[model samples]
Target chain A: MEFQGFRRKDGSVGTRNTIGILSTVVCANEVADDISRHVEGATAFMHQQGCCQTPVDIARVNETLIGLGKNPNLAAVLLVSLGCESTAVGEVAKAISEAGKRVETIVIQEVGGAAKSIAEGTLLVQDMVQEASRLERTSCPVRDLVLGLKCGSSDTTSGLAPNPALGIASDLLIEAGGTSILGEVTEFIGAEHLLALHARDEDVGKQILDLVKRMENRAKSAGQDIRGGQPTGGNIKGGLTTIEEKSLGAIAKAGTAPIQAVYEYGIAPQVKGLVVMDSPGREPEILTGLAAAGCTVIAFTTGRGAPQGFPFVPVIKITGNKVTWDKLRDHMDMDVSSVMEGEETLPDAGKRIFREILQVASGMLTKAEISGYTKAMDIYTVGPVI
Target chain B: MKNDAIMIHEKDNVATALRDIKPNEKVVVGTGDKSSVIQVQQPIPYGHKFAVRDIPGGEDILKYGEVMGRATQDIAGGTHAHIHNIESLRGRGDLER
Candidate 1:
């Protein structure tokens, strides 16, 4: 269960050593992206938030950025900011520096223009990468692993196969004293009762139910039904009907473990067994939320096909469609389609997936990771642009 | 176990195809007491659905014991139950519907 990994000064273990160029607001995304383009081994964490949000929402944005910079996977961080943006770029750099990683900041307004900021940021990132390359991995136990669970573009086989297989893997990780996080609160609407059964206590169970209620209310107030935009076209073509039916299938990814805790979007889980994070169902937002929560690896289940991965974490894409596996082989990591053809049992598929997770954790890159499909990541926001 | 295909729940009148059913290929449904063997009108892919009982126009198509969509036209056993013949009842645009 030991894998070679970089140990961060904050005491967190990371599978990948990366230098991150983070944009403090939407305005500075171009600068960060430009800087990242010039620097090898550098990834940009760009998002559309950081200005004119309600105080609570602004704080949430600020916290997620700071957390991303502090993530152990990052060997160093460079914050790119627009001088007028409300997001606290200075505070973000201070937090990451305190976590013991090299941290620096570049403000476009103060730096004169985008060109100058990009030049300065690129040089800064190159230096960080040099420092990052000097760091070496040490033996880390399985218990230190933080795993994120997510499924997108679902179809019938998702419920029948990959999700349950992932559940088994989640259970195995938890049994090894690792942390597993389940996200996408909207999908839990119809299946909340099932998940509540796994809560650590009645209060946790109620909290799980309440989160579902809030999601439903948000949709309702927007003059839409929860099912209005669910089970999407791909899902229906793949044979899922109601939100209830999809939920029934979705919960299989949790395996059969007790829910140890629940967390808000982008909040790190305090205790680890199986915890739920409140996140939207979109790939970019949810993936960002999970990574910001400090997951070192992610197990993503897709039925139709989704190929995006995060900047610093390894995403293991598992699919149940043999056709998708063969057709999109370049994008997918593992195929449990054998479960559908009766070539493999659920447990057998689960074991195969678990082994794959171990392999990836030990430095094997996923197909998405290999193709450099990490640019489509963003933090979810609910406010108007300002 | 009848093994033709499972209805998933008692409330569902349609069953998903566990394997591909070729056009005009005959398949059986239900058990001996109420069994019926019908020919597929068109090729239906695996993981897709076939009508278990007759579904008239405007009736909702049930699968997994819930309404997946409403039948836009009469659907018989062994016919593909998807967008061409069924329309989503949950998230349709009013004018389009």
Candidate 2:
């Protein structure tokens, strides 16, 4: 029920204690990446929606940036700003600082250019990294762990094996008073009604239904069937017949916990136990949203094999397909394929996944982390860039 | 406890093949204490679903005890039930104006 973690001054616990180099706008990504590259124990979050966007999306970018900075995994933060972008850089920096972490800002325009900015940011990041390194691991209760659940590249075994196994793990964590976030609203298409049955109240249930309706409406508004994009070609090849079938399997990741609350994309949960967040099923956006929602660690179930990880949060890739496990050994962290073979029961497999989660939270690097396959990241934004 | 195929819920009319099931193979499908044999009418690829009972055209395809979609054509028991035979009822912009 406990694991070694970095205890943040704000009372949250971190599975990793790294310096976060956050690009405030797409224009500042290179400078931020350069700074992170120069400093050990520093990771950069480079996103693509800080300028030329609707006010709603711009606000979303700013809020997501603040949420990322507030994540306990980052002991300190450095905002790399393009200076003229629409993102509220100063507000983001202040908000992060208020979260009781060291925060600094470097404006590329004020620093002359990208080259000079990178140099200045690199020095700032090196200092922050040194400060972050001073923080030692301490034992933190499972209650402090915020777990994010996601499944991608799903096939039939996904729902029957790893997804349900992960569900058990989520249930275990919740039973121990830990928090678990279920996202990927798009995947809830067909199974929303079933999920609503688990909601703590009628309003929460309605919210779950509404999130699915909104997601489906968005696809319909574009004058296309959601199936054309969802249940992707890989999913279809993997034997998922329709969005409804995919959803029934996907919802198995929620386990049996009562849904505590529902939140918009990138917003952190207010209550503990099980909650839902609105996010598309794509890896880039969902991972970013989960990170922004303050997940200390993420459990990603993939039937086919998805390799992406977050630059800061540790993503543990689990698979239920024997072939995927054998072929993508470098990307997978755990194999619950035994469940598919009926050699292992779902709860037993779930216990193994829960144990792996604790181990990863205690600093064991997942295959994704070890292979450095953590760079495909982006902030989920709605509306067009003007 | 049949290992060849699994019927997740008792109400499910379809079962998922744990391995490639050839045509005419009598596959045992069920979980725990409840199980039944289905003589497959067509090849059911690994991870694919096959109707455990005859599904009339336009009827809902049940999996995991929930409606996954509607059968587009009459699907005989033990035949592969997939996108070819079933279509989702939700998010069908094709049905919209």
Candidate 1 lDDT at B35 equals: 51
Q: Model 2, A374: alpha-carbon shift in Å?
A: 1.5
Runs off by more than 4 Å, candidate 1: A225-228, B1-14, B22-45, B51-97
Model 1 lDDT, residue B39, Cα:
70
lDDT of 2 by residue, A1-386 (tens): 79999998889999999898999999888889888878888898987889999999999998899999999999999999989999999999999999999999999899899999989888888888877788899988999999999999999999999999999999999999999999999899999999999999999999999999998988778666767588898999888999999999999999999999999999999999999999999998999999999998999999899999999999999999999999999999999999887789998999999999999999999887787787768988879989
- Flag regions of model 2 displaced more than 4 Å: none
TM-score of 1: 0.88
Model 1 agreement with the true structure over A59-134: per-residue lDDT tens digits: 8888899778877788998899999988877777887798888889998999999988988888888888998898
- DockQ of structure 2: 0.79
- RMSD for each model, in Å, please? 3.9, 1.2
Q: In Å, what is the interface RMSD of model 1?
A: 5.3
**In terms of TM-score, which candidate is strongest?**
2
Output the lDDT of residue A131, model 2.
Answer: 74
- How much is A226 displaced in model 1, in angstroms? 4.9
